[model samples]
Target: MGLLRKAARAMLSLSLATRPAVADTEIDKHSVDVAATARAFAQAAPLAIGDSYDYAPGVQGEADAEGRIGDTDFKLRLFGAWDAQDEERRYADIRQASLHWRHDRLSLGAGVGTFFWGVSESINVVNVLNQADLRQAVDSKEKMGQTFVSLGLRFGNGELSLFYLPTFREREFPERPAFGLPVSQRALFETPDKGGDIALRGLFYAGDLEAGLGYFKGTRRSPLLIRRSPTATEWTPFYIETENLLLDALYLLHEATLKLEAKTGRELDQGFFAANVGIEYPVYSLPGGIQELSLIAEYLVDDRGERAETLGQNDLFIGLRTSFGDIGNSSFRGVVSYDFDSQGNYLDLGLEHRLSDYFRFETRALVFLNAGRDDNWLYPVRNEDFIEFKLHYSF
Candidate 1:
């Protein structure tokens, strides 16, 4: 880790000396857009046997604006969602508000933004720049914007990026009464008090292969839960009403990618290593005009062993995607992830079809299989299988 830090500093110093001059040419443009969605969700199983079925209705609105002014670019995005069944699920957030400046091979950015890194299908162990927005989804596919200042330098066949994150963001969670973990199990979150975080990443492209290496030193976005009350009783198989659980932890991450991906992180007290290797291939034009079918497979492994909580220790993810290259630009995707250690599995299916230039229809379903007590992450929400339908309109 010390060597990594020294290397990052050296790269930064070298890049600073080679900063390119800004161009005098001016190109300014700006546009604003808004989107709204109405969604409905239905649970596949009762929270309790004989209990009433759970249903939820939700609506979301998003506003976005972006433009370029000379050598600088700016973007802003805001989102709000309302859920009738879950108060915790109803929230508003500033997804992005950032400005970027580029001069030849050098680029710099600041403000709140979101970044996705890594090449894994089911999990993103190497992508930690933003906090997970669990209020929207438990799959970790959604991310909250993070405030940071970043600098990037492009040289040779690679680019190096340095980030100084000045603020820490915590992961959002579903309300205590939600189908997932109970409120009592909620961790007591504390904001970090000292200097924030620092991260560095280098990405290189060679032939048809792309690779990246990343390092992060600072607070962990995901908190670790510590039982506060030892005598709390379980009210249901899925819900436990414990008084308060302390959730605080920090860690360092070292990740590398080679067409495939690998990651390792160390908490203040413990550490774990993880990896994912996958391939994606597409078959063009089946009977339909300009249609394509894509196949994907990724194997995941984590060395946290039985103690792993959020991530599956060992799993395989297989996915298929179909693109109907018609006027509507419709698509369908399905993924099945199986945990080798616990023999538990889940399937995710999604379909999206553009009805017109201004409207679209989408639906998603998550189904769990054999997610029993032996399962690490899925055991808590074993019965919360659900399907959601949504209609979105943009203007």
Candidate 2:
């Protein structure tokens, strides 16, 4: 691996230093990024799930490169991860590979890429362009790439964009049953395998406020779990045809920021609504050389309430972020989420520090509280609290 990286760097430098002049096409600029991480979890596997080690080890790597030449630009990214305990967790993905062209107010792009479309931090109900990569994490924030052709028209204060996606990626899961329920490997889709989707969005910017309006019609990224047969003990993912209207906005107010994201959609032939509203307020110059402290709070609401298919239904999330302003760039974040209906709570704590110029260290802890009731979504994993540590190297 070291030899390959050295060769790649030498070739890139040689190509840039010894390029031939061509038809007035300016060889603009290029950049490359590579990183790797070693991680471990200090948690024991539940006997009900399977036999596993008291500690789990994992590794991850990613590389990205981008360049711009004249009126066209291109980007590529690759990522892979492997864990010792689960075969399903060992996989690689092409997160992005695309070419984009722009002239005046019009722009076009083609290829596979990942897209993000929400302003809230806790949860984003409007981000549906790419499929979720659940094997990597349970937050549903990670995503797989999608093949698409996109066009955009820029105006005075806004841009109108349209996307035509030609492919769909299925969700991934662990071999062991999640929450002690059996899950099948096969997935069902309402549309044909190749039947793609379409989306349109308009973004506007004015002073301290940023807002967007979006519409999507196609396969639902979030699937409904259904029994494969009447008597079967296993469940399969079922992706249904759906349509959604999305709204997201951010407004700056002095030392604080206001964020709002809301979506109303039709999935599984039923209408649903969800929203997240939050605020971020920062206080500078605390005691004991503390550089800053940020307070984050958000409220999550879903019309389905306790029967929602996912977590964060009628819950409140509060977080505190501390920056030390030290040479190692140390920071810490702590969060607590409380379920209003179930009276359950979740706690998360994270700390990060740069060990050296090329190395970084991070640690995180997750705990569940008052989740003994089976009706609560977190009940199955209530005893699955764990702490994780990671070391990252980048160049």
Q: Each model's TM-score, in the order given?
A: 0.79, 0.85
Q: Candidate 1 — what's its lDDT?
A: 0.64
Question: How far out, in Å, is residue 83 in model 2?
Answer: 1.5
Instruction: Show the lowest summed lDDT stretch of 10 residues, model 1.
Output: 240-249
TM-score of 1: 0.79
Clashes of 1: 0
Report residue 68 deviation for candidate 1 (angstroms): 2.8
Error of 1 at 105 (Å): 2.3
Alpha-carbon runs more than 4 Å astray in model 1: 1-53, 176-181, 184-195, 233-259, 306-311
The lDDT leader among the candidates is: 2
lDDT of 2 by residue, 130-170 (tens): 88887765567789877777889999999999998866676
The TM-score measured for candidate 2 stands at 0.85
